[model samples]
Target: MGEPDVAANFFAKPQHLVKVNRRRRMNIWRSGQGSPTVVLAPGFMAVTADWARVQPALARTAQVVSYDHAGQGFSDPGPLPRSPARTAADLKAALVRDGIEPPYVLVGLSMGSFEVRHFAHQYPGEVVGMVLVDPSFDDMAKRLLKVTPSDQVWIESQFTHLKRCELAAKAGDLRPGTDAYAACVFQPQPDLTEALNKTYHDMSLQASYWRSLASEFSFAARDKADWPLADMPLIVLSAGDRERPPRPPEEVEAIQRVYADAHEQLAALSSRGARRVVPNSKHAIQWDRPQAVIDAVREVIAAVCGGPA
Candidate 1:
């Protein structure tokens, strides 16, 4: 059997550069030819290439496009002060710049979900529906702190470090995926070892950009007025396994509970949406469990493409 390669050539190519903001230029990847477009967003520390698992599945139904975010992969080093809203704004610009009209099905995974919600809120009219894979609500992180402030602070600090690593990776200066990220996600896929290793190595180099990015997180952390987009039609997928190593079983459970609550928060956002659990998957559900990602996306597309039903 052939190994899964999310970045495999599928007769698609990047056609143009969309200047999203002062410093962000989104590299748009495209495939298929149809209406009711679908735009994809990469996860934290991952470039658009991460969707290598599911993008082809989506291209069959609609115009599917994914891009590396600024300071992440294939994109220019974005301006400082990047947040959920700012990222969403960059997405809107990328879509427009690429000639992908509105009324799109925006699919985001993990960290990408945060930005997806912001995009739906910013351009509700343009978004027809959404698919949130292992979603993350802004307050989701805060839940961790509730248990023990120290734990939250530790995670916050870790997240800060990873974001820095991501920037370095984007600049082609270091590795991309971390060891933990690899052990949990990449190692499962033996076929993409070389590519995965490349991504992992690339992400490792982004520490150079951490200082400026740290400030952006503070601003992005600020809450938006209302979650108008949160209520948009969405399909949220959850991972079955939520284990963090070296931590006690109880500690792992606590993290799962936090993710569970976040999932509930995500489901609560939409009257027209539903949630599903992707079994035996990790944070990188799309890569670790590609079929689940495809299945969830199909469900969402069906709802959107379903005619008057």
Candidate 2:
């Protein structure tokens, strides 16, 4: 994707920009009041608003902090060539700068789950709990390669599409799937405000945002092999009702089995980790079954607080 200067006239409302470092300013949204803050980490190309449905509910019990990583939403574009380690470190720095005290319960969705794991592994003492929502696995690339011959095509097509998005953004033309991206990432529900809808659409059109996403996916598996085994309260929330693409039944089932196995392995990372399959929900569990996300967060919060789990 073509690199562009950070948008000057992006957000309407006044928001806090926590300086994670001299070069990066991370945008963070906070609500509620309590110890053991619940941090919401969004998926690929997702912004803080993606957690709109679940954040409010969790805020009722404990402090909730939802943030956009560098190059997403209104956050400043970070140094190029982003990796999960850099993202996690930036998040930790921002949290410290914002004065959000720890004993934190991290809630991560999709690709964001890797950053959460990195944070927990790097700063085990700061994190008390975790909720992984339809997490992406470390060995996803290797597994997809072995699935089928077409899987290779699918993987390559993602990079191709990302390049096209970059070109379109540079030419001031919104990408073909901008609407679909907005609908999936931001407007998880039907009643999204017109202003919010427009914000998501604008963000989706940025070439820098797509480039950051591409970089994250490209190097996700490299540093993930040495994943740590932490002793903390962890919940692996898997989607029980994921949409099946048009593929042979055997291949589809094989992919699903691999997903199931990966999630189970994630749960085993912690002695306190447990796996839960949310019925009638897909990858975007925060949108389809927000209550599940809220419950998982609360369960973790409770565990950390020595309350009923």
Expressed as tens digits, the lDDT of each residue in 195-225 for candidate 2 is 5556766676777877777787676544463
RMSD of each: 5.3, 6.1
Question: Per-residue lDDT tens digits of candidate 1, residues 99-191?
Answer: 788778888876777787778777768887888888666664466666545565666776666565555445544433555343222233354
Off by over 4 Å in 2: 1-15, 171-191, 221-226
Distance from true position, residue 243, model 1, in Å? 2.7
Best by TM-score: 2
Q: Give the Cα error of residue 77 in candidate 1, in Å.
A: 1.2
Q: What is the TM-score of each candidate against the true structure?
A: 0.78, 0.87
Candidate 2, which ten residues in sequence have the lowest lDDT sum? 1-10
